[model samples]
Target chain A: MDIFDGIATGFATAATAQNLLYVFIGVLIGTVIGVLPGLGPSATIALLLPLTYTLEPATAVIMLAGIYYGSMYGGTITSVLLRLPGEAASVVTSIDGYEMARQGRAGAALGISAVGSFIGGMVAVVGLMLLAPTLADIAVGVGPPEFVALAVLGLLLVTYLGTRHPFKSLAMAGIGLLLATVGQDPITGATRFTFGQLSLIDGFDFVAIAMGLFGVGEILHAIEQDQAVKALTSKVRNIWPTRQDFRDSAAPIARGSVLGFLIGVLPGGGGVVSSLASYGAEKKLSRNGRHEFGKGAIEGVAGPETANNASSTSAFVPLLTLGLPSNVVLALIFGALTIQGITPGPTLIDDHPDIFWGVIASMVIGNVILLILNVPLVGVFVQLLRVRPGILGAFALLITMAGVYSINNDLNDMWVVLGFGVLGWLMKKTGFEPGPLVLAFVLGPILEGSFRQSMLLSDGSLGIFVQRPVAGVVFGLIAVFLVWSTVMALRGRLTSGAEMIEHAAADEAELEALRSPAAPEQDRADADGGGDARATTRTTTRSRHEEED
Target chain B: MSQHAYRFGALAILALGAAAALGAVQLGLGGLSAPGSGLWPFITALVIIFCGLVLIVEDTPDDYETWTRRSGKVGIAFVALGVFIPVLQLLGIILAAFLLLTFWIRFLSREPWRLTLVLAVAGSVGLYLVFGQFLEVPFPVGIIGRQTGLEFGL
Candidate 1:
């Protein structure tokens, strides 16, 4: 369908009273939860998945899409005010955003962020409207081998690019794939690993596992942190950016929109990566140079906020066109659609125009709602941080249990939720991010099924993976990425060795400074508090090390 | 946790990889074209084993959060979650949630009894109104609901 017709159909379907109510609820809940530390879009969506079981597929997806991007907007509020990045994407924003708040420009910072995010989100929607149908058309004829390529590429991209520890991420992905193989064999109808249990016959319930890993796990972890959240409740004034602030931020807003849209289309390239990349670009290329960075720079906040929001919208392209979810949040959305018996792929637009178009239309409307709601209600949302973490965690835990139980009313699923929740907490404590694992679990079946089919089609010739043009190109790109990553790892190792030496010298210098009688008054006061100069030096050094990492 | 602790985690995953591979083998690994259920799993198990080995050998990443006395709260929290299932079966969701919320707020958060009671009561009723009454989620009626004849879910 053409863009205009599809959009018209979308608005017609999405503008219904029921759909509008859900859209508002989703974004509002998304923003509120996003303002709370440690409760991200993924967990919120997982907790709410049971509510979607009875809704129309289009409505469910529309609400989920709103939650996904709405959280992006909401995360910035905490990052700016409290410097307590609520979402990963807002971490960069915290640098300049918190500084702006300290400088009493919190209102201008938030105002510009909302305006930039709106523009970015709008640009991405237009891009999606223009690009998705064409991409879907191109992907319509792809077969099993091509599917294998896409799945592998998506998995590899996410693990390699989306994680700090590639080996750990890959191991987690392997575990996820193994878990996906727990039920009956797709082809032979032979139970692979059910252990003779009836509940195992369906393998693991996606909702249960998701709620466990993200929802329960995150709450368990969040409860470990200090519960006393110091709030910056000072009323923000000067709500609009001055003319000079607008002039400085205008170029960055435009640049970030385009940059984010392009990056978001790539597998594993949205959210934090897009925002960080935009921040880096602005820092290097801005006419103001680097002096203004980390000191209430309007461009720093404007660029990243726009980029992250834009990227969140554009990330939908892959899922809609190729049935490939680029990140963990998108994977949960994929699971939701699959539960509703709707497979997202090249034929989605043709098969379910309402779902495809209605969701896209809802995003445009949701962004408008976020802008309208955020500007005036930023103060209201910030108050959510005042709610005790224990109370919030208790409520979140209850919702998780009730939500998972509602799915099939099976007690076994609750056990799964508890077990995975523990595993998730352990993973977090051990420096393993569960994002790749969840994404891999969702993609596991497609990868295995297509891989087997491709082998059969080629009469057991493994070369079939590279014989098709699309698959061949994908494999070639994967090889290039592997080689490049290896080179970078080696370079990083060498540089880290030098960095370790520098750190040792800095530690020595810090110790000397602490011991010197001519030390600064603050250092003397700190020394007097403990009267253990080595201890003071050690604490400072450790914090500096953590900051550098 | 130290690097030694991470090594143990790697070893555990390595053991799991071995066990999964054995299970896959038992499931029967056919050829590439006409594969059995075990083929994909076996390959994945091998990849897992390889990753585990790499993690064991390489310098561990320094991103882990160090556990402190505060981590004991997580243990207490898990115990509460563990008790919830039986409580849910015995008293239905509303009472179970009330008790759980009260424990979390009054004990874990160290809040005043009045605030804990207020939040616990309000939260439980609100959850029931939404999940049981509105959404009809079919939660267990339990001993109390059955004796009182007060079923509230689909």
Candidate 2:
């Protein structure tokens, strides 16, 4: 059947009462978690993964997919109203979003964001429908050598795109790969790292590692900081933007949608990079001379918000088609699918058309649900921010421990969770990104299997990797990224060392601003239980200086 | 001496790599054509060692801090988790969860006693009913539950 026929079949399947309910619940939970600081989509998905065990694969994926994109919508609320980024992708949004709020145009900022997000998400879903099947069909011809190259390239790109410190990321990836070898060897049946324990025979549980790293680790970090967030007391007056606002944002939204979709297709270039790139592009392309780029510019809010949502939707392409997750969130989704006995790869589309198409259909439906939920119930979501971190952290810990144990009914898994939780906390303290490590861990066995298969096929010749055209190209890209990053790092150290220090100082100042009250009104608000108002003022002042610089 | 911490971390990684390499050698690294189980791990260990060497060279002095400042909270948290495992096996998920939550809320976060007690009891019992009774997950009844003749049928 054609793609349209498949999607239609998917819509029919997803239109069921049970499936629709799951979609609503997923998006609802997604928005809630997105609005709450310290609980990102990755952590939320990891925390809820075990519950999906009894669910049908399609329904489970549909719900998880909702959470992924629903967060994009939820993140904007805090950025606009509170000058706080709910997630990394929303960091850029706070620049202009909070400015708009300061100018009492918060409604316009949120309205444009919601509309832009809906459009971007819809476009990305269409792109996913068109691109994923074609990519899968093309990938069907891939040999083991190509698979190895692809996995390696994916690991490299994700590391490079996600962090400033590639070496540390690589080290984490290496550790993850090493950890993957803990179970019995796939080919030889020889145990490598189990140390003779029977439970070690099956290897470390994926759910336990994920829950520990993202969930428990995040909780520990949050507890140490103990920062209480204040909700916006000012009512969001206008939920709809004026014609002038729409007119200004039209091009930016369109450009952001396409840019975000393309970027999202790349490994490690999902939510964060897409929004940053979109913001840069919008800044460069804006023709309105009177409008300052970062000072409450509609394009600023529209572009990044749209792009992040679009990127999140399109990130599913690689995972669904090539069995490769482009980022950490997708890695968690991949884990969810694996636990459901569904291997996500090229064959996934052909084998489980219901799951593939049903998930895509659900994304489109999810966008509509998010828009409906967000535009009306935004105040309600803001109120949710009042729930104290202490209470939330306590319950979250209990749930994580219980949820992880349910995976295999093994107490040993709890040990794994606690161990990784400590490691994850240390990694956080030291500025090491756990994202690359988790992704590499998930992809490590596949990479190793493919590499060995290629070796065996070529009679153990290393030349087989470069001999294949696809593998050769992938390897070339990997080499280019490595060389380019090294050159960039060297150049940065030589030329921008002073500038980097200044940037760090400014970042410290910005953080300090967030912790204190900036203005008399804000001081009053803080005195009245508003927590910190200096964060908002500093954001505006800092952005102005950034514009000047 | 903050720079020494990075060097120390690098040294730790290098030591780990050396140990892994030693283990890999014992596992038997065959030739490339017909690889042994140890070949892949051995190569990974070498890569880790290279990374450690590079990290030592690139080490900056300001990265490390005294562990005592924040380590107290992390140490306590770790101790709580460590205590939890044996407690879970001995006392059951319900009692274990209650104790864990109470400790975290009461001691770690310093919430009020009434709030801590309410949350600890409600959270643990609610989770038990949801996960054990409704989801039908097989949870250990432990000495307390068994002694009380209270069994949750999975």
Candidate 3:
């Protein structure tokens, strides 16, 4: 369909009462889940996936997509008021946002975040509208060799860029790939690891594993943390920012929208990465960034928040057009789409334009709903912190069990959920992230299937990978990335023990900035004198250590 | 985390890789031209083993969280859920979930008894209303209902 025709159709599809209701429910649940300390977009979506089984395909996707970006707006509230990130993407926001809250400018920080998120989301929607169709056109002619290249590159990028310990992440991904081989071989009908169980013939349930790993696992892990949270309540009087605040944030928001849009198009480059990169760029690029970064800088709050929201919107481009999920959240949406018997790829736009454009259009409306909800109901969402984490954990566990069981009406799925939940908890305590693992699990079939196709087509010649131009370019990119990562890893290892200790100390102080309201003052003072050096160190540490969504 | 933690994780992965590799070999690894069912799995197993060895040789980073006294609660929660699944068949979802929720809220979470009772009842009934009734999830009617001749949201 043409762009204008798609837009009109999208509006027609999304404007119905049923679609609007789903959108409202999606954003509302997303906002609530985001406001709560433990649940993130991934877990929430995984928990709700089975429930979407009965809905229309377009409506289901529109709602799930709404939750993904709406959470971006909801996440800023906790960051600003409580100094606790509602999700990983909002971690950077807590640095300057909480500082602003302490100075009685909480409203200004939140207001700028809301305004910037709206602008960023809208801009990204426009980008997606224009870019995805063209990308899909280009992808239509791509063969299995390119598919192998793309999947391999994507897996490598996520492991290399998503975590600090590349070896561990790679191992997790390897495990995920192995897990994907459990049911039956795609080429041959022989089972690889079913172990004689009838249910094993179908392989493990994706919904069950996801809900277990992210939902049950997170709740189990969350219960172990310090549950005390304090929201700055007295100083939230004015909801609008001062004119100077707007002036300071305007440039950052624009820059963040552009930066986030570009980054989100790349695999493994959204959520935390987008926000952290934006924060780092704003710190280096903004005029007064050096002085204002850790001390109630509206620019600092505006940049990361705007970037994360924009990245969330634009991350849809890969999933809709290429059938490659750029992050874990998109992976869940991909699962949801598969459950509805719809394959998302280059043909998706042609096959299901209503779903493709309806989802995109719903995001435009969802962003508007988020803006309206955040501006007026910020305090109400803040009050959700009072609901207590323990209570939330119990209910989440119940829902997870019920939801997973309902998927196939089979009790074996519950076993899978509990097994993965424990494994997820254990993984968390050991500093192993499940993001790469889950993404690899979703991509494994595609990678393996394409690889076999390429091999068969070429009569076992390995030259097939580099024979195609697109595949050649992708492999070349992968090689460059590998070399760069090795160099960085070597450099990291070569640092003196004392330097490593110093970096670790600086990292602790940054963590302290998130945990304690009083700590930012010391952090600000440190930032004021030689903060750039420490800031660089902190950015490197976070990029390596922080969890990618 | 301690060096011991890193060693343990690496060893576990290495063992898993070895087992999977054995399974793949038994399944028959075919040539490159006509791959067998085991070809992809064997390759993945090798990658896992390689990653494990790399991690074993590397210096341990002090980034992981260690278990505290409070971590027992996670174990307790896991065991309870494991038991709850079977009990769900015996007592049905409503009664089984009620009991589980009560135990979790009252004991595991250490909330007030009054609050625990209220939340457990509300949570169980609410789940039935949503998943069992509204969504028609077809939850099992357990021994309790079978004997009592009462079907609760089946």
Candidate 4:
């Protein structure tokens, strides 16, 4: 019948006690991981991927969806309380959220974010329920060439949103694609890059690499740096938002939801770009005299938080419609779908309407669950770091290792985790973002496959890309992005060079400030962590030193 | 000669990846077959290698002494992983995991035995329930469990 009636059917399937329980569990577990520093959706989903084997396809996807969106709900807690981001997507949250905490408006900010995120998530789920099947129906007519063009466009959009570092992002993505290639040829029955380990025969398990790169890698970096974030006392002066705060945040939340959902529909688009774009949007809409954007602004928290949630929910669009996933996390869910013998494309609704509709309804359920679970537990989460970082770190490593081993029961998988963990640790130290690398690796193989198949299908004629209307539009977008990124990169390089020279000229003044007693506290603690008094002194000293420098 | 040679290092890796990919292509012409799986996997490698070459050629280096200092923590993490491999097969999956968790939590995170033991046991049992019983995937039984598989109905 109608889309709403379809969603009603979805609600009936998703409302069953068994399915509701799964959503609750998924959201709770996801929120916990999201609250913890470095425990992100990709790693958590990867670690839990094995357990989905027995679940009904619909049940498993609903649960996975719960976890994916649930993380967005919990991410703001750490960002606001400890000034530590639980995931890269939440980095923007810390800018205003912690500032609000510093200004004694932590409770209000948290309230706004929780409610804002809920609204955003609900809006996107509605989009998914309405749009996914319609899009899948439309995609039915597309050929290999169209898919390849769409994939190229996805890569370009992801790379473009990758900001001034599109080259690095593209490189990481390219490398990831190559890594995806390291398995046996399914059709030709030839070993491509196994280098002879039997486990390598199936190629690398996505779970293993996700664990190695996202989970184990993050733990290694967290431990290696040994930086303990300070927890904020719940000095939530205001629990409810003021009328002014609500008025200011309403339009931004609505805008973020629309922007985030649209952006997330594109392949490889997720947390980073959504957050950044939301921040940019908020900044652009600022009042004339309000230049206080970077130091801490409420719009910054409200916009990004809403955007991240909406985007997270909308990510299901491609996975559900095209039978293709844009990121590693969705890829794992796709693998789960494959195990259940249901391909994820245009035929999903036609063949299995229950599966498609049930998941969309479950998102609505999961968002409600997350709101219930996260708000009350915010107090517990805010103070989590009060427990020794060392103790938490040990448990994190153990769980991560155990999870990694469970993935394939292969020691080599654990070794891979260690290798990437070390690399991640190094990258963190070196100011390189590892998120793009992992994202790259996930999308790499699929893009290559799509591109090559399109070429082969048209007998190596580049004209095939433009021949299809959809494909042409997608490629046109890619061309624009490529051109824009090139110009931006050149400008960025020049500006950075200029900035570096300016810094070099001011080096002596910075050195004097560093030696000064009033230097910033984190830098002072960086030298030594003798006691509380010492730490406070260090922070104070560093701030003053920073001022002089 | 630059302070950070990572660009060169990255380039070297890229060069190596490219050379390896060329060798990979010699084995197949990339899927003329059903799903065309070969086309994507094979060509992706070539792109990565090319990008690696670009990264190397356009490399930028930075001072990196801080990374070298955390060798102790890194060493322990790797060693813990090495210990886990042989243990899962010899010891029971639950016992092996418990032991692995204990060492990692107790030593790596440097927590007390009380906390580590509880976490280790909880983790193993949770894992057994999910991956083994619920999923119905047989975990690798230890020598002891294997010898007594049917007896315990494992």
User: What TM-score does the first chain of candidate 4 have?
Assistant: 0.82
TM-score of every candidate: 0.90, 0.89, 0.91, 0.82
Q: Model 2: per-residue lDDT, tens digit, B1-154?
A: 7536656766776787788888888888887888889888888788778877777787553333235544577678778888987898788888888899899888877789998999898988899999998878888778867887876421
lDDT per residue (tens digit) for residues A273-333 in model 4:
5766787778767755243555456777888889888988888899888866765567667
lDDT of 3 by residue, A1-549 (tens): 899899888989999999999999898988887777667788788888988898999999999988888888887887788665676677678878978998898999999999999999999999999999899999898899998888888787667655556787789899989988889887788987999988788787788778887778777877775554453454676888888888888999999999889888888767666777788788777554434667777888999899988998998998999998877788888989998898789999999999999999999998899999999889898888787767888898989899888888988888988999998878766756676777788888888898888889999888988878989999999989778767877777532212222232224555555432222112210110101011112222233323321
Question: By DockQ, is 2 or 4 better?
Answer: 2
**Candidate 4's DockQ:** 0.36
Worst 10 residues of 1 chain B by lDDT: B57-66
Model 2 chain A poorest ten-residue lDDT run: A524-533
Error of 3 at A455 (Å): 1.3
Per candidate, chain B TM-score?
0.86, 0.81, 0.85, 0.67
Q: Can you tell me the DockQ of model 3?
A: 0.65
The runs of at least 3 residues in candidate 3 whose Cα sits more than 4 Å from the true structure, single-residue gaps closed, are A231-234, A288-291, A493-549, B1-5, B59-61, B142-150
Clash count, predicted structure 1: 0
Candidate with better TM-score, 2 vs 3: 3
Return the TM-score for chain B, candidate 4.
0.67
What local lDDT does model 3 show for residue A406?
87
| Native-to-model Cα distance after best TM-score fit, residue A145 in candidate 2, in Å | 1.9
Superior candidate under lDDT, 2 versus 4: 2
> Which candidate model has the greater lDDT, 2 or 3?
3
Query: lDDT of all predictions, in order shown?
Result: 0.79, 0.76, 0.78, 0.64
Q: How close is candidate 3 to the true structure, as a TM-score?
A: 0.91
lDDT of 3: 0.78
Better of 1 and 4 by TM-score: 1
Ranking by lDDT: 1, 3, 2, 4
Question: What's chain A's TM-score in each predicted model?
Answer: 0.89, 0.90, 0.90, 0.82
